[model samples]
Target: MTRSRATLALATTAASAAFLAPALPASAAVTKGLQDQEMTVNQPGLTPAFLTAAQEANVGLVRFNTRWDGQASAPDPAQVAAIKAFATKAAAAGIGSIEVSPNISGDASFNPRGKGRGPKATDKISQDAYRAYIRALATALKDVPVARFYSAINEPNWFRHIPQRGGAILYRRLHNIAYEEIKAVDPAAKVLFGELLPYARPTSKSYPHGQSADPGAFVREALGLTKSWKGRGRTASYAVKADGVSLHTYDFQADPSRKSSKRGRDAWVHANLDWAKADLRKAARTKRLPSAAAKRIYLTEFAYKTSGSDKLSTSKASSYLKKAWTVAKKQKVRSFLWYQLRDPTSTDELWQSGLQTRDGGVRSTWTTFKGLR
Candidate 1:
């Protein structure tokens, strides 16, 4: 969870054989590709470079999560301007869409250990706040043709819960309310679900029985009849289903150090994706979930750290990133997104996943991915 430092450099999004690589035997399909980045509310200035890089990489989408604290009372005008600016820049760059969330885990105040606002309290207030946030966001982007989808929150499953309720319940509840509010204004906008944190650790304190709720487990719980997600039925409304599923993967955390032989990493990717797809398919089969108009997986975030205290060499990071693109093509994932367009805070540990270092320098992964398209 701690991000290390890295040298910053500008990256060019030039396509490579790697980006257009053929499918691997065990991987899914990839259609659209994206890169994730952190942008603060009211910082619309950063959108141009991000869209430019995304266009260079041939990726059409960018993912960013909104912090509830920043927009709880009324949506921050600066943040609103930033999103609109992103859309304008993306359209000029010919990038496809933007995904935004309200109930994301960025604000420390909302996080359990940070300010102790706790997930439950945050969830309760944020859920209501999200309706307004999404409404306003959608309204702002309404004229922006480049934008495709909007989300209410980032990863709700990681939020803490009260004694009786857990993160899954809170997540589902928020999604339900948010979806209703979103569609009430804009029915055409697509909503994305399932932005689960990639790795599931056995030591995590966020799940039932303390067994650790990985992405799969979170999905299982959401679809489980006994769970009563969102303090109501396990089923999500049709409006919620209108949005496609969203996901991010980073095997580095699961198997850092490139220590896991290639075979092992491939196996891990195969298993994780297979399990997720199977579960979604099962839900659809049981008629418990709506069928996706589009059925490919979207890897909203994926990267290997290349510098700082825990730096992987540039060569190794590039190799890892290439392998991920290869696997995505093989897996037939609808689209894959690299972690970031720009590195915001050098102090923001997670920002190390960026294609560029904090100072705006390129990592090897950045070059490799540029050629991927």
Candidate 2:
């Protein structure tokens, strides 16, 4: 899940002295010959300091969000320019790939009036608009080799992000449009299904925010394992166009070793993947979607919050990071991205999941991450 800009205020507190420990040497243990595996940070910009730090740590991917708002049927020109600039700088810094998420925000001026934030159940954006925006984005970045991976949306399963009554169906439509638009511009480009917020069960009906759907349930609906929603059953198959799935797997606990007491479910780091894979396999068999079972699983966002109820001491966070990587490798995850590179310094613990303090001082997990393959 991407942090709202309001949640990323600079830290006012001083970095803890313990974070002053020296970074591991470059010759430190490196995973030899791992293929198609990437360690990335989901920072918004490609700042020089961040790029330098990422290079030193041998991290080769940077994922960031770009907006498709402020225009009726195209991305904002300024946002397009910024993406191009980001790609150029990332390549210069030796980053291998850049993942772009074309997120739709709640800004009224950018979206059709009355159809953005807190959208009514009947609100819907035309497919033509979605296709045009996606096509423009893909065309703008087509020549940039690092801009090979694109996500259709970000956390659409979350009600606030795409809050129509039949959000799952709406998101599937958007994803299909985006996949075609992107592939039309560059067939080699890989368009990922939008990342989903991991929730063991579907959001409760009485929940205050829009009706957030469970990630598993949304995937099932998309892949045709479940019947179409109230007004969304027209499409014969929603799975045919999707290339792969992306997930944001942040468990409630900071310690990955703690097993989920839920019977028949895998523990800790395996929680989301175990259930997701099972759902996909069942859908694939029922719907005959050939690649559904083997589709690449990208754990696009995974990290322990360093503060709040989920807070972990620096040492514990480091240990969790290492263990999480071990589990992801064993599970054959395609890409694992730490949610952020720097923590927000505010007293709010939810925003403090970075590997470094807000002031850019290295946290213990920075050392552990550098040593990961």
Candidate 3:
């Protein structure tokens, strides 16, 4: 994941404190959530301990990630059971599930560099295979009452990620595939759209290795929301569909109130999610997808880096968090999730944005995050 290098450019100096976006009153329906993939899945005593933690924190939802091939193959039955068990327990504990499929559409991998099969992300996913797997997974999980919202993939806007080149068009197709399948299994189920990274590069052009697509371009093309969208893809029938718009943000260097002056409408950032929502609504209107327009924006993943001089000061991180909630509230975001409850084990880890440090210390942002409406 050239993601480390991909985001290095967006690291801007923190914004002025006095220049905050006018904060709106928090929405009463907003459901705060947390995403600690490692802890929620592998934490010891997951039932009494982890489940209790989520219950205590008022977590309305928790995200669970899996690969398409893992469940489809059924080679290791426990892997599938673990997912069902987690959702069942979370439901019992009063937390709903947000399932994310990260990779591998079939029961095999293709190493683009070599013929031998491996986990090197060299080839794209096959939509047909992915659709079949998602349908099965959704049908299997239909028994788990809490397993409802499904996010197709994480960070489709990241550099060199799977389902690339096709950009939003590619991602939209994948999302629609999952959307139709999951909906078939549970009509009440929702397929989240655009688990896109929150950065945008310069306008369309041939790119060097490791550059990200202009997310705005991806979003528009994916939904056929462009200026003249009626004739795209040589068809009047819809190409891709989504129930809700999903975005992931970890724009560490800037404050949430810091809007992209030139790129706001074209891409997603903590500040520009409102623009994305408008796009989703416009697309839904043009496409006549009623269910898609009814969803509130879902900020599925977000965090601020703390502890290092290069990162935010604990106090600043906390301030930024309060501002993030302000942005969310103003945008009427349905869910605002911090990336992880605890930071990775060491500073070397790429995602240093966690509510609690690995050494069992909590940052000021912990209280600020834990208290978000």
Candidate 4:
């Protein structure tokens, strides 16, 4: 998150991979992992370091995000090669699974931050080009047998990744295309979607134009579960389908077990997982869309900020993380990833949640992460 060292993650060729881990016991049903784009992806030389540290903390899985740029027919060959190499190295290190998401910075590929008349409206990558990019990357990985658990994209509900105006509709189209392309490359490939942003404003009106939609609204609209927000519906050429729904469940201001007292509100935070799970179940069974997707869930990214003003500077992350694991088990989460491993020196766009602190030492939360098992 410090923006200097974002690299790759581990991988599995298929379900039959010999490195696949045994299922955890009931008390440790959740697969605890880390999502440090920096330490895992950027610093290959540091692999042995983090691998040892992860083993110390009992982390078995890692999530890596690769930012793909330009309209090249595919992702960068060098990056893919590095990722494949990392996958091999990680598997050798006893890492059980990996999740990779190829993301595009800003709203489009025209420029890093398109903000002009020509760049703003027309900045989007065409459907054909995007399809080709996803297809090529997935194809390349699949050939190497590395296209294991692929996330369609980062948080589409957030304004930073996508323009909030018609954002869910746009993400739905992209996700469906990604699904088709990845599945076309490897029919058995596991594709996951919707690492939705967990934070929500207090009121519906709080999300004005250009601001992001809440996770609940984004899910209903993107999945075409509502009459008003029906996007390229069941009859459309592209339908929404995924093996599991992923969400970010950060509740930094309070304990993860803390619930909102607001009545009739659905924000989809950690405390509202029941609400989130119900929605997933409905989608899995709903006739409006394909019932191919299951009610499975993945908590792809979440952590409490230890130093940020947003966290009020006195929060106890280690304790909350312990409770978070309990909540995850109760909710039957398929995967649980802390947002990052090590913290930056200071002031890193508001995210300071790390099992290891900026001092390059483990936090009490590091033990908390291990105590999940």
The per-candidate count of clashes, in order, stands at 35, 0, 1, 4
Candidate 4 residue pairs in clash (backbone atoms < 3 Å): 5-38, 7-41, 7-42, 8-41
Q: Whole-model Cα lDDT per candidate?
A: 0.52, 0.58, 0.59, 0.64
| Tens digit per residue, CA lDDT, model 3, 229-273 | 333553354445666677776576677887756555656778776
Candidate 1 lDDT tens digits, 124-160: 4555566667677666555555545655555444442
Best by lDDT: 4
- Compared with the true structure, what per-residue lDDT tens digits does model 2 show for residues 16-44? 10111111112222221111111121234
Candidates 2 and 4 compared: the better one by lDDT is 4
Q: What's the TM-score of each model vs. the native?
A: 0.73, 0.77, 0.77, 0.81
- The Cα RMSD in angstroms, rounded to one decimal, for candidate 2 relative to the true structure is 8.4
Query: Which portions of model 1 miss their true places by more than 4 Å?
Result: 1-47, 70-73, 103-126, 160-164, 204-212, 225-240, 253-271, 308-310, 345-350
What shift in Å separates residue 296 of candidate 1 from its native position after superposition? Answer: 3.9
Write down the lDDT that model 1 would get: 0.52
Worst 10 residues of 3 by lDDT: 14-23
Give me candidate 4's TM-score against the actual structure: 0.81
Error of 4 at 228 (Å): 9.9
Find the number of clashing residue pairs for candidate 2. 0
List model 4 lDDT by residue over 276-359, tens digit each: 777666655554334444456778888877664656232377777777888998988887888867774445435666677655
